[model samples]
Target: MRKILATHPLHPRATAMLAGAGRLAVASALDPKTLTTEARDADIVIVRAPLPPELFQGAANLRAAIRHGAGLDMIPVEAATAAGVLVANVPAVNARSVAEHVMFAALALLRRFRVMDRDLRAKGWLAGREHANSTSELAGKTIGIVGLGAVGQAVGHIAAHGFDLNVVATTRSLRPAPERVGFLSIDALVEQSDVIVLCCPLTAETRGLISRERIARMKPGALLINVSRGPVVDDEALIEALREGRIGGAALDVFSVQPLPPNHPYFGFDNVIVTPHMAGITEESMMRMGVGAAGEALLVLAGKLPVNLRNPEVIEHYRRRFPAGD
Candidate 1:
């Protein structure tokens, strides 16, 4: 039986499906060294965590690296292609889940949910009631979305249709703007928005896209919501802004460091809402991602390319490595 390695546990349904197709092994630990050792003999790898490029060096039997979700950042595509490995991913499977999370974070920050809940438990009902004075509603607010990808589009839909808010966006795509959504330059979007949402992918152009200078451009008391990769925003710049109360508040799901260091400065700010990179995780989305990843694995095992193949240029090398009719 061919060996399959999963960086983390999949939904039970996906687990059973892969088990029937190959010898499935879930990683015990996520460190680079541990994953490298565990994946050396794997024919297929379902990636959830970052896969070091060096893992491809000695993985002779590896034919594919399948991402459990949309982001390709976790898998080094260049390294995989160089090693004759196919890279595939389940894209947009969790767009709704992440969009919902963005709304949740926005509501939590605008309503002062965390502080109110804390004070209610520690002090009394009246203390919690006092927080209502500072709360704001979503109606009639102008929301600016960075990147009009699946997640961004979903967020715009909810903001415009569900909350009766105005939606504007910036995107690298050449496509026409969606109805009720106006396209704007990044600078304009940042300046005019009441709520700025970052849904762009992490790339050379986007690294530090929301810099200290841009933070200065934001309207005073404007809210920031980042569901994108961590490094897109300057952590120190944001903290400085929050300290001076330059902006209203922020909701951050991804961070520059995983498990954000204990006693991190962000935790000290009541206006900042921090989450453990779980914006795309929901029971429904998990199953969809898992099943999608597993289906790709099974296709590769059957000597076929995945439907969502991310690296088509690697096909010649892959075919040579695993010749057909063998």
Candidate 2:
């Protein structure tokens, strides 16, 4: 059987499909040494952890690196293309789950639930009840989205139609947005929005999209929510804003670093809601992503390109390598 490797343990649904097609192997750890060794014999890799460029050099048999989720940042696209490996991702499959997570965090932050619960546990009902009057509601607020991808658009749909909130979005695409969502420049959206949500990808241009100065431009006491990649917002800048109380609060589902380090400053801030990059993870979404990724893997195995192929240029080299197939 063709060898299939995964960076992490696969959901049972995905495991079943992969095993039926190939001899499945999952990495015990994500270190470079382990991955490099494991990838050397792999014909296909299902990626969850970041794949290094050097690993591609050793993966002589690797025909494809399939992403379990929407983002492709984990895989080095240029190196994969150079190595004749097809890169694929399942987009929009988890949009609803991520959008729902954004809404959940936004509501929790606006209502000051973190602080209230902390005080309620520490100083009893009186202390907690005191925070009751300082909360805000979601209705009638304008939500500005940094990106207009599947997750961003899903968030807009819910915020506009379900919550009765005005939605404004920024997108490089010239296509007009839905009637309910007004397309605006990032600067204009920052100034007018009551809630700012980041759902953009992590690119060089977007690495520090929400810089210190960008946060300064927000309406005073406006809330910020990040359901996108962590580096999209400047962590240091965000922390300072929360410390100074310049902004109302923030809900961050992703971060520049994983595990976030024990006793991080974010842990001490009641105004900041820190999640371990789980905005796209839900039981339902997991199944969808697993099935989507497995289906794509199967297609590539059968000498067919993925329907959601991220790097099409790799196909020319791929066809040369798999001459007998495609």
Candidate 3:
């Protein structure tokens, strides 16, 4: 039987989908050391957790590494391609979940829900009601989105239709222009928008995309939300901005560092909302992603290419290793 290893367990429904293909193995935890050992003899790796690039060094039996989610930053594509292994990811499966998360953060910050609840518990009901006059509504605010892909599109739909908010978006694709959202350059969008949401992928050109200079361009008191990768925004610059009160407030779902150190400055800020990179997780999205990953794994094992293949150049060596009809 082929060795099928999962960095973490997939949904039972997805396991059933792959039951007929091969034997399944799982890591004890989602840590680096555990994943490296579990991935040792895997013919196929279902990546639910971030893995080390060194895992592919002597992986002669590895046929494919499939990401359970859209982001490939968690999986090192360069090392996999160099090892002649196929890399694939399931995209757009968690768009709705992340988009809803952005909306939740926006409203929570605008309405000062955390502060109000804290005062009511610590002091009295009157102290909480005293701050009710400061709350703002979502309607009529201009929302700027970075990267108008699946998640951005979903956010635009809700901002425009459900909340009656004005929507503006920046994208790499410009000719056709994404529908239902006005197109603008990043600088212009930041200047005009009341809120900015980042859903862009992290890349060489995009790392530290939001620097001090860019942060200075933002409309005063404009809220910022990031559901994208952490390195895209300069953490130090953002912290400085938040501390100086140059930027109004921020809701961060992803960070440059994981677990964000217990005494991190972000933890002390009332204007900032931090989450443990779970914006893309929901019951429905988990089901869709698990099912999608299983289907791609089965395809690769059957000597066929995955529909969401990230590295096509690996095919030349891959076919030579495991021919179509072996």
Query: lDDT winner among the candidates?
Result: 1
> 149, model 3: CA deviation in Å?
0.9
True-structure RMSD for candidate 1: 0.8
Per-residue error (Å), model 3, residue 60: 1.5
Off by over 4 Å in 1: none
How well is each residue in 94-169 modelled by candidate 2, as lDDT tens digits?
Answer: 9999999989998998888998998999999999999989999999999999899999999999999899999999
| Backbone clashes (count) for model 2 | 0
> Candidate 1 at 71: error in angstroms?
0.3
Per-prediction TM-score, please? 0.99, 0.97, 0.97
Q: Candidate 3 deviates by what RMSD?
A: 1.3
Model 3: residues with Cα > 4 Å off, grouped in runs: none
Minimum summed lDDT over a 10-residue window in model 3 is located at 172-181
- TM-score between model 3 and native: 0.97
lDDT of each: 0.94, 0.90, 0.90
